[model samples]
Target: MRRFASRGGIDTERGAPMSKTEDESGTNAQERGDGSSQSSVAAGRAFGKAVLRDARRGAALGAGALQRGGRLLWSRLAAKTTKSERRASPARSPAPRGPESGAPASPPFGRRRLRRLMGAALLSLPVIIALSAAMAHILLPNLEEMGARAEDRQVFEDAHGAPLIIRGAVPSAYAPLDTFPRHLVDAVIAIEDRRFFQHGGIDIEAIARALLRNIRSGGIAEGGSTLTQQLVKISYLAPERSLSRKLHEAILTRQLERRDSKEQILEAYLNSVYLGSGATGVPAAARIYFDSAPEDVTLAQSAALAAMIQAPSVVNPLADLEALRARGALVLDAMEAQGRIDADEAGQARDEMAALVPRPPAIRYGTWFSDWITRSAETLAPAPRGVSLLRTTLEPDLQVAAERIIEQHLAAAGSGAQAALVALRPDGAVAAMVGGRDYGESQFNRAVDALRQPGSTFKTIVYLAALAEGFEPGDRILDRQLDIDGYTPVNFDGRYRGEVTMLDAFAASLNAATVNMAMTVGLDRIAQTARTLGIDTELRQTPALALGASEIPLIEMTEAYGAIATGRIPFEAFGIRSASGMAGQDRIALNPVPGASGPQIDRIMAARQDMATLLRRVIDDGTGRRAALTQPAAGKTGTTQESRDALFIGWSGDLITGVWIGNDDNTPMDGVTGGGLPAQIWSEFMIVGLNLADATTVGGAKSLETTPAPAQCNVTACRRAYRSFDVSDCTFQPYSGPRKLCTR
Candidate 1:
């Protein structure tokens, strides 16, 4: 009944009719070529020509031109066809719907095209899926596991190549990854890495959630880090909480994924992560927590340890056993949710954990050597890829003796004094090292880490330098009051011996004489000699360095002296001898490497002879006389300023040892001199360490300058028996050398 033009100017009603002028269809008279119609047709043809011309003009322009051109072209085409078609076609019912009607007409392609498309899709469904899966496998795969970094422990053996123990923060044996119980692996994976098998190291979903949480909290509030990232964090990076560290972890994890197989990564992560109770890695945790190995662990036990991976200290069995078990139950539930284990198995595991009570680990055998070995392994050998087998230079019995000596002597010395010792072969193989009196009391390694002044023992290096400078031990040097550059040095007695042969001065450890010697031989040269001899610790080139003012490490000091005792070819102070994987596949030989070329053998021997006299005098009648052993050994005693540090460094042909005794608090020790306790310890160690005959022939540096005791006579046996200061001494007058006789 009503009709109207809508927004688009289209008639809204179906039955609407237009006036004859609006219809645009020609009037019947015009079609019949009436005079008026003929004029209209000519006008229409002109209009068509004008539209065509406009379209051509528009087509020459850009984007706007294209739109205009298309619109003009369509309009022109429609004008030509609209009237002709309306008159020629039969009448048809109009569409029932309009713009107002929600039921719009079907797409022009309509139901037929849709049906064909559906049929094609149905027919090729399998093929499409197959190709998609193939592409996914080439790229992402179905959570295929890449390899993980292997956390291998270092194994240390005794001198005879027998395994002493595994040396690492964690002390545990290697167990094959695949052999680990399925439940154990499952529990670990469920708690530590739920999508372990699903993700390619980085989890975008978890990261997004973590980022959101972090933004909400205005700080790092959550970690979406995967197990692989955790491995990289603990192994190569510090545990600092930072965005950069997280980024590094993410990158390292991706690399690990690309380099390792999935099973390998999981195994490595499981083995290396710190679990709890002073343990590092899984095997260690197993031993420390359950007193069992990884493979032997039950399902409940596995879950219990797995729970600690997130907050080891919080769920620590040592601190909170119940919490540990409770967390373990949660792991089982997670597994059940993932259908990794049945509900029945989860319930059974829960019961098992409830019934079990783990005991606190009773740690045993805390030795400084073990601690040192643990740290040394970082450089001596690569972490074991499978199982580490290390051969060390340790003499087990000697190590025991060193430990016992420290303990026994420290107790006897009394008064909170601490002692450290280091013993090595002439070639620089460390045989025995004691870092402190008791490792249980403290883990500080005094032998290598401490930097106490060497006192007079430093004179050994000074004397060595002097020998290099063409000064003979028997050559006389003035020890009278001398001042150099506003600094004055005195003997231990605070008095100067006017003039003594270099031999006697060194033997007596006269501070003034030693400083004079150091001055005679350039301070720089002395420092250089110390370094060249194997002392890697920094040294001062000042004159005070002569009197041992610059602090140094005992191990390095011993190492330096060991080079001399071995006749001056440079060698490193080393403990590791060789290493191999448990399977014996990757063997790494850690043999000694020469440091630098040294003095010729003849020169070293000659210098040794000169110092040999000096070393003998000290043990004979000088400061170190109290340290005299029945064997032939030479050493110097050192007493620091204010008796703060006392040291004795001595050697035979086979070994060199350094002993230090002092108050850890640096309080004076009842005027303890290096000759006292240090010398005594050195003597005691050598007695057990060397054969009696070998000891006698040890310090032959100056053997040519001294004659052997006459087997037939003392100064007495020649005429009548008489005694010298030495009860066992068979004294003859001083002899020049092997061919020269003693002159009275």
Candidate 2:
């Protein structure tokens, strides 16, 4: 039997086994007290061990999950580390622990290190996302008022309300989306952006594809811009290639997509895209290329227009027909592939492209005049947006006549010679203008831009100044050779009259006599007189200036002559009569204000009458004798040295016309004088113009009969006999029968 002695009220077992009876008794005793306490202690130890094992497993799993998430975030946020970087790094090994040390083995990633890294990653994610969101928000663009950016039509009309030229955006050329044919829309989409409808503003798949292709090509040869992106760029961003710009474009694109529908976006894009040859939109391109409306355009024409999108100046039909045809074939093939058009349709489109002939150029009557008026209108009344109607003082018939006359006269002059003609009404309104022989040959507006020596035309200014200083038409001056300083001016014919009246010297265009008059009046006063008459060109105060050595624009000289014809100095020559737009009608002051005092007005009137008398003498029997008309006429002939410039400026009735003929290179013409070619052209034009005016009079022949004639004059019979004579200037014929007659 095993015996247990109790010490301090505890039972102790010395031997391994006890008797059956003793075992039974011990078991019962243990079950009652100490056995229960030992069991509870063992259970507590087991539970603590389970909890410890679970905590260790959880920590390992959490570390692995956090590491994976951090790696994914890094891959998304930054460029991936290359394989070369991995190869360059050395391999790490686990450190061996000493037997005496009690620390457990460290994980491949240290627990503390893992905790710090994961904690940082967890904390940075929200900040990074917030920053990205803020940046995207900041880069968003304003999409309000999309139509405001579109160009509006500008229509320029002549005095008769006839459209001289349509400039800027053509109203008829602007077509809405519904007006566009389905084939046109499909063609544009197939060539520009195939996934326009399917993608969000930023097409991720397209971007990836473009990226891969660019990488293989070793250059940025492809762009993944969707239609929305292109619209955003055209509307807001400049055409620049940069990551920052692309980012901004992408952000704006998304905003645009969210704000507008696909149809709206496509419409704006089609209407705003620039095509070649001054066409700005699909409708304009269609009209310019095909001479057809938007909806009437054939599929092949639509394809050609779409092809122009890549490089308008290079691929347009008018610029490069072969390139346009080739590109249009590609567009057709794309449309066929996308199932927008059948293969047979594509073939037909190809045939149409081969047969395509661009519309012949339209006959533009007053291009130079329209361009000048447009520029002036922009400066005077700028239309930010919407249609602008510019009513000008131009007469369509007169413009046509002027153009024809210039072409006819310049043909005989020579191939290298060019001509410019400007005609103004007595009130300083521009009636007709021809900047060059052909505007298509050169866009340089010689009438308003070219500064050439006015020759004797500027003598009018000197004489005008003399008259303002109380010199009369009969005021006599020596017309012999004269030298002032180092400048010596001689007459055009090299023969001078010893002494002559001011009117005779002027009509003969005696340079020496004109210079003497300029000297008497002072060059400064002459310059001031030129300014008062609307000659803005700089005039040298030399003696040569008196003989028209100063260079001046044809328009300015014409305007000065206009002032004399109207008896008004300091008046502006204006082409635009009225300009109305979305902003409002511009209050254009066409006529000069009556600001001159009584005495000043009287002086100007007297000078004007004297100048008129002098000019009439030149036309009647002097240098401009060839320019005389049956009715009262006045003018001056100007021939520069070596005949480099020849001009005839004259007035018949209420029309003031200035004609300039010269070589563009400033070379001399063979025996071409102002009295020869320019005067002939001027006479022919004036004859047609005055006849047309008379024929179109409100009451016809009856209107002429109403004019008050001398008491002995038979107005009707005299007009019938002399169709060209004004009733007031006619006299009764001596042998008058029952049917009274009159003569000039």
Candidate 3:
């Protein structure tokens, strides 16, 4: 012991020996009358010398090891060399003593020494892996502290910008970790990471077990990722399976563990982890699987959902019931093994979870409208990267009203029927559109997709052509059976009104009179008029076209009438208000400037004022009498043959609404006419819910009557002018104006 102390440079009788430099500095301090400072300085100097001596000895040992490693490496390289290369080694060549040979090479390590060195290297491998893992964690970026953020969730809203729903990779609502039942958290931790709280981000024991299992299975059947590693994998690293990604995930996991507590990590993981079926987080998963809130999730349901964390698609409760129950059993076993639940409790929980099955999520109303906005938004810009806002023209009140009316009407009518209602401003901004009775039942937007014939409602187009062709409002025509080219046309009542004025014929929807006018003015002219009004689809030029035989979409028909309601350029229907994100910025203009070139609706209505009068009379006393409001409401009613389709499209003030009701299979309703059910529904929607007072008449007032064409030479006023014409052959009277034919 005395010899060992002396070698360590400490005196046995006293303490550590004073160094020469400390002895000199202490004498100088004593000379300045600071004896206490001298002794402290002497002790510090001796301790530093001892530390330096130990460091020098460590350096010598490290150098010796390095030399040994070099010899072994050179010997291995020489062993691998070819015979010709081996001849160049010093062992195979003659010694050279010339000064040009810079220095002598160390001899290669003997085979025994090489084996010893290899044994030392093998023994140090585990230590090397441990140190490397520690260094990797230390060098990792401070991601948890740096505050990285995921993309903001996009929100779908009502037309007026009220938030309706949120969509993304998942919909999430963060909650405190304690809010979940203990079994719920235990189930996740048990199956995913048995040693979650004990491990420092990565568990070597778990990894070893996983590797062994994978090797035995001859495939990657197990994943050893701890909870922290999974969090780092999904949040920070790319989802690709590669060495670099795994390295990055491991590094970020350690960094995450250092900065956040176990509870915080659990909260974040439970909030954003993808549990399957578009359930991004635990809250969304609970709601989607149970139709209940997160806090209300039952233990059995929670275990089933937790089992999905390992292989969500493979263990989908809805798709593979047996597989899901098996996974639930495994989770229960793990929980019991971890002492989180007693064996009896685990058995009872397993039995309960075995009976659990998937429940379809309850869909909220108005997703059709949201989907419509999504489709329209895709056209306006690229898909949203972050939150996107779609400003729509939908009125919640009117939408609710329309939905209620369809359900009531369908039940009362006692038929399996479908109805669509679309209401818009004169400028074409859609206000309310109930495309079907229940959007949850069907997403097919019938308002934009259905094409039905507008029976007498199309007569407006035929008569507009007649008014422009010099026929006055009083040009009487016979509403009797008429035949042309072997096709006879009759009135809806199948009875003849000998001769009725144009206004009376239109009010009663006298088919023969309307057909007579169509033949006289030409079918081509009527089609052109309908197209100009707003009907974009093809129109037939046959006489049947005059009787509303052409198939046109309901929206197109409503917009065509909208043109006549207000002369302004139609507002192209749009729902998206604005789109913005990390991608870029885009916005939609609310009111676009009207074009100056087209035939204006107000102008055309003003020119054909007599047509407006006829429509008003129809609503007042004719087929559309049921649609009359407190004010002068002008609209046309249309019912197809056998009442196959019923339509009531009209305008009050600048607001135009069109309603269509029929079976999807085109089965005729029991005596349902356009003027009966459709008109009443239109009245209910417009007056009861839409709340538009008759602010202005559909068209203001009647214009001056035009001079009748000279083809009508039956009246006494034109008898002298038509000297060679037979008055008895004419069916209508002539006009009393300065006739261009009379001038001859």
Candidate 4:
């Protein structure tokens, strides 16, 4: 009844009807504008919408190009389809019949047509032959290069930074080209890829057979990839389990065969193949599982490696020895079928391999030293980024000795107690570094890490400072309790021995006397003295520091003690000498510095001389006397307040050692003093390191120059006595002198 746009609707621009129905009705209404202009407007609107739709489609297509290209390239690269299968089907050929039986002799086609067909077939034969020759000469090399690049390779090294001790890898005996055990290779080809040699790379018949087997099994029970195709996949492609990936692998395999020699391709495949247990190559795998070289590997071993390649992680010898053996036997069967080995050889190899001794748990013997050396080597001569080997100076003997000493002593001390020891040469080169008893169980290197109070060991530095202050060892000093400006310091026993000589005070570790001496020289001077002697630890500016209140690591302590033994020169502790990359089958030295880093001229040399004398007195008469067994040794015993930390530092002129015994948690032990376990460990390691040499050969106090002393305190003693010159009064004074006195 009511329509908005009726037959008389008009266009504002053209003043015309918008539709045919409107145009006819518009004659009676209005026609003041151009009807052609209205048609143009509608056509332009349609064109704009089409342009927008096309732009949207173009954007989407551009976005998907990269992903689609990648997929296409991958498929082309794989190309697993066989040319024979892709060829025209013979079944599609016309059926043949007996001569003149059911079909006409020539089927109405003239001899001329037949002749033309024959001529076409005859002409194609030469072309096909020529094309094959061109492929053999041109395309083959390119394919081989692709396959070679696809194979995998691995590199590694030893603790000494020696070249890799490869597993499944063929040895130098088979070097230049991998020469597999003839039997092993034969068996693999027979069981796994029978047409391996005959085919350029991909095996069509094998692939067809595998496809049938897989379909029957309803799963991937058999792989269709030929050895070459597998090599192509392993070497050049991501190991994705997709049909496209397999297709690319087949193409690459064909390309590889055409380009490379059979021997070269096969060798690369064998060498690069994974054999489980983190072993990427056959040589590495052989050594890992059988502790044998690749050439020396038996058929069973070869079979094992071969089987491992199928599913390395599943057939890993380290994880499942039985499965590995079973897989290996299968490999052997392949080798036997391939005529690579005789039945007898295979059987014997199988039995011998099965009887191989299982690998033992890793030693992890020098875990602490290994880790420390590893870090040190990194700093000394850092490897390139992504490098795995680190050169180090870790002597097996030193490691063994340090470990045995730690194990024996810690076990003897029981589990509750902890100890640290560092043995170094006089030049500061570390011989053995034992952080704790079981470095393997605990990785903390207490030798270089833990900081504990030095106790009496700190006394040596105080005395050295005193010596630098012109104090003589033989000079007399009062060890009795005395007030220093009203601040009285007592001995360890809280009792003072009256009027003892300086040597006696030091020998007895007289705390009051040492404090008095330190005060006389000034605390700052003593701290500076310790610093010069290689003690970089923080020192408290208190009188207690005179008796080792400051804590230091055992390595620093030994190194300082070693400097003292060196008689004034500070030597940095180092293990590695130098390292160089391999050249001509030998490692060359990178640097020729004969010594570790330290002060050039020892500023604290004289102090070290005095320390030697004082420490010798400690072993001869004081707390460390027990440390001297068969030779004259010099050492200092240290125990902190409440006996929370115990330390003993000693040297036999050849080796300087320091030992610390305390709980890692810093909880005090029951009656475990430095003179107990620490001293014993020091003694044990020192004896082994020293070799019972004559002590005189090393720098001893006997070589030190004796100093003249002031007898001011001595003269004070005779001041109270009767003097002839001071006798002003002529009183006999009881004449209590020795017989024949001046009174007569």
Candidate 5:
């Protein structure tokens, strides 16, 4: 024991040396000035001495082994050579030099070779380290902007510049730094980036593990990204799957760690992550999926989001059920392992999440109305992103009623026929729109896009222009076959009812009577009246334009009628009322600009009232009789040649509506007329639009004289006789003498 103690460099005191434990306790070791025992001091000294001794002994033994092995092989070769030489020259003998000459017979290979090999190994270490560091730094990309970009905000609004109520977006109060729950953070980290808290942005241990697994599995089943690295990858880097991109992501992640706190980085990461559908960020995702805030999410919902992160489309609840459940189960297992929930709770959460029903898809109601809304809103702000909320003058109840009426009428008309309806308020504010059967199927809004002839619905403008030309309702006009130059105009039935008053001719839509009136009233004056009523499209200068030869869209026609409804005060129709900047801070109020507002409703009121009186007469007893109602109303019915276009435009004290039914290809409808389906639609819509209001006329409407006057006139008779020279031999005034001779 004493010999062993001395060999170990231990003191041989009164008894045997202290034990290893006692020495470690520092009772037999050195002490510090602060009175704490330096227990590790002896162990450290022992470890260092032992290492040195082992190293020196290993060096000596290695040297001897190499020398001995070399000598043995060299002596054997020399022996074989000498044996061959002896066989050839047996008489020769070689002797060594004498000891007095200070030369040995053999050279030593022991220490010299050891020194050379050691020097070489020592020289190579620094070069290897330098090369490795250079490659690692050069191959990676720089991604310093990822976190900053993730923290930015996005906005959404409608065409009327109104803040849109996005279907699946969480509000601001549910953001990560505020209302987002801490468990969500844990679940994401646990499943996506374990060891996130311990790593310095890039997890080397995880990378090596992932590499080994991939090589063994022969596929990329795992991603070796820290959460910080993922944030850099998603926000700054393109989603290219390559080693070079991964290296760049790692390099940027390290840099990000140096610039931002872990919490700040995490906040940005969660906020920017997409949860699928149309949602772009976490708040948006939360709102879309749960219809709730982030903090309000249950464990099952959290698991659903976590599952979606693996493959958002494949596991989307809105997509596949079985796949989503299987994916969600994987997330639950991860959560359980992370101690976020117990195993039983995790399983229960997964089951519950699988059974949850997804929310409905978004609704895009008021298709045509939304288009007008967009246009009117565009006048205030050029784009939806620039404005906040737009307050519209829409009466929702009235708009709904109008849509319902049109929908019911079309349903009654049955399929294979499409219709578009537009309703406007007295002030020229569009209230409702129904473009087609489905907004999703076709966004091509017909109310504002389809251009068709106004048909006889345009006669009111011609009559009003005649009234303006000092032609009274009782003025003598002829309904005989007429001729103008080489064109002969015939009545709708191809037969003339000779000698009719202006009121009777307009009320019955008599083609010859209107032709004569167009000549007497001047076609230019009629076109001007149409323009003043808000028909902006060009009308032909010829008297043929007096009939409904011009084509107009529903929106333009509605605006024109809207002027007459408001007593001829032409106000430009607008959808948006106001706008604001981001977060509702910077507000810019918009009003109707000039030039869009045209003739005062009062100036044209008398003429419009006169025309309306005649039009109501038409609905009550003339061509538009099919559209006549028990209630007092003013309206016109129009049908194009070959029954191609049918129209009914009318207004009550409450609303003005236009209904058009025809083939989109301009093919004539099967037996359809202005008085048939279109009138039905107009009457139905007005009934609901007026909503039980008593039938009444505009209290101060101008009245046409209630009389029957001169039925035959010289000018009209002579014009018709010359106009029918080609199509008809019958003159305006029948001749008692013979054919082809005018008896005036």
Candidate 6:
């Protein structure tokens, strides 16, 4: 048992040891596994608890930040309230947060709160901008005031109340929106603003497209302004392209859209938009282009007018017919594309346009007269509120004749010379006036504005002064070269007769003799006589004054001669007869009738009769022979130095006319004497004007019965009748009498 026990013991020991080792190893391994499992489970539980705590803290912080942001926003909004509310409310203290409340103190402007405030500011940015824009929009100009200020219309009418010209913002015939033809409206909309009705005031899509186009074209090829915007521009804004102006226009356009309906805005636009050649609206355009009413405009005409909206000056029917037709075709194509008109209608319109032949512009008769009337009306009647009808003294027929005559003479002259003619009644009423050769080429009213030397025509005043100073026409005067006060007077022909009667000296335009007579008659008396006859220009006190050296206007000079014709002193010429308007008619005050019955009137009549005899002698036997008429005519021919100015002023019956031919720059004409072109023009015009043949005179018939017959006397009897005699011809001449006698 011992051996076996030993062996058994060994075996048992080994076995038991092995078993115990195995059991112990298994136990240790099992225990170690169990401990590892427990540790892992504990670690997992700890980690999960830590994560829960962190999540809770984060949620709490987030909630706190949101609450602070809400408080801040509320405070800001509340601070914006009225100060009275702030004063009436109780002030709230910060909440108690020390030991009484189990919460930690929060720092002012913490990171989370800063972030929250930034987010709130970012959220309210668009609202702030929108509010600012609204306030700015409210502070713009008043639309109604602008519209009222832009509603001015001026329609000028001729003497017979025919529409002569239209001017200003709105035309006389302002067609309403309803009066616009359907095709016209469609054409305008298609070409100018396709989405006119769809836009409020500005079209964003259109603007973008225009911007892209402009960028591509490298210029402003398109203006994306809607109809509302265009109306605003026309009615309120100035015509300037600028960023600031565009901004204001955009704002005003929005205001207009808000204030007026689409139709009203369109009506205003159509009535005020400027279509060039002085047409301000569609009505004026229709009347001017087609000579028709706006509603009666044909489809092709409508398209053409609509095309003018883009560039009126360049593409009008008068300026460029082909350009207008091309633009009209584009407008028609656009209309067809917009479905405003079908293919057949578009084709018909195209055919009409292709068949269209532009009418030649009406001959604008009496443009200078019309312009003068317009200017005169400004002061005469002050252009009462709306349309003014100035009944002028302008006889249209006479004006037409005068224009044709002037054109003919100037064309024949062809020296780049200009002429001015002023015709007046014996009573000083301006009948016809041609200011310049072409009113379109130049606007200078030479008749009323040009101050030129009267040359020898001024001798009439000197002779009148001499006559007033008791120098009879038959008085003997030495027609020799004379020098007085360092001034020498020579005859036009540079030849002088030793002795001649005053009538012969006057008829021959003997400068030296007239100057000598002027010296004897006193220069002051001559100036006074000129003023009495209606010369308003300042006269110089010199001997040259006798030789017509005074610079005077043609109108004033003509009026002075009118005094001679009418036997009236201080005669005033007038153009406007009557100015009729919305107010009562104003009969323009004219020069009073020759009612003076004193010695002054008697002296004027005597001087006029004597001067008439001398002037008749000039036409009968002297320099003014070219100015003779079928009936009795009297005039004076005046030629300035170097032929710079040539004039012929005359009267037959109750009509007195003055003609002047000269260069605009005071350049001399090519050997043009007073008796040459000027006298011829005067004679031709007078023949037509006086209607000596089949044509009766404009104002009245010639008074042949009033003309005194020439005196018949022998040499002895004529010498006894006058203080002088023509020894060369053995003729008796009376210079200061109503009639002159020559022994034939």
lDDT by candidate, in order shown: 0.68, 0.72, 0.66, 0.61, 0.62, 0.71
Model 5 lDDT tens row, 235-340: 7888897434554566677777877788877876776676667565565666666665678777777777767776776667778767777777777888888787
User: How accurate locally is residue 716 in candidate 4, as Cα lDDT from 0 to 100?
Assistant: 24
Per-residue CA lDDT of model 2 for 548-614, tens digit only, reads 8889999889878866776554445678766565235553444322222223334554688788889
TM-score of each: 0.56, 0.65, 0.55, 0.58, 0.59, 0.64
lDDT of model 6 at residue 127?
52
> Per-residue lDDT tens digits of candidate 3, residues 1-744?
111123334332233453445345455443556666556555755664454444334433555775788686766766755544556867667666456677765544455466676677656555544543432333323364334354234444455444333232222244468888887888889889889899999999999999999999999989888988887766666668643345557766776788789998887787667877767778777766676667777767777878888877677666687988988888888888889889888878877886887765544334445556656654653545433445555555566677787778778878566788877754455666767776656777777777778788898778777886667778897777877898888788888888899889888998998998899889977876675565778887888898888888778878766655554323244454455431345543444224222222333444455666777888998999999988667789998888888888887744578888877778788888889888988888777543533222211212112211112222454455565434444222345532122111
Ranking by lDDT: 2, 6, 1, 3, 5, 4
State the displacement of the C-alpha of residue 28, model 6, in Å, after optimal TM-score superposition: 99
Q: Against the true structure, what is every candidate's RMSD?
A: 23.4, 25.4, 21.5, 23.8, 23.0, 31.5
Ten residues in sequence with the least summed lDDT for candidate 2 = 698-707
What value does the lDDT take at residue 587 in candidate 5? 56
Off by over 4 Å in 5: 1-219, 222-312, 331-348, 359-364, 368-408, 438-441, 470-476, 493-495, 498-504, 567-570, 593-606, 618-632, 692-744
lDDT of 4 by residue, 1-744 (tens): 111122224332332235654444355222535565455555644553354344334433543654565556445434533443366488874466557468655522333444465566556545544433322222122343443343312233332333222221212111223445765576556656778878777667877888999899999887766777767766687756643344445556655676678887776667666766656556556566666656776666666666777778887777787887777777777666766778888789778668744452233344555456656554543433221223334443554666788678778767466667777655455656777766535778888888888888888878877777778888777676667567676677888877777788887888888887788889987887666556777888887788787888878877777666765333457655444322222333332222212222223554456667788888888878767758767888888877888889988746778888888787878887777777887887776665534322322222212311111111222234435312222112335652211111
Clashing pairs in 5: 141-248, 162-390, 168-288, 170-283, 482-723, 483-723, 567-601, 568-601, 569-601
As a TM-score, model 5 comes out at 0.59
Least accurate 10 contiguous residues by lDDT in model 6: 1-10
Error of 1 at 565 (Å): 1.3
Lowest-sum lDDT 10-residue window in model 4: 707-716
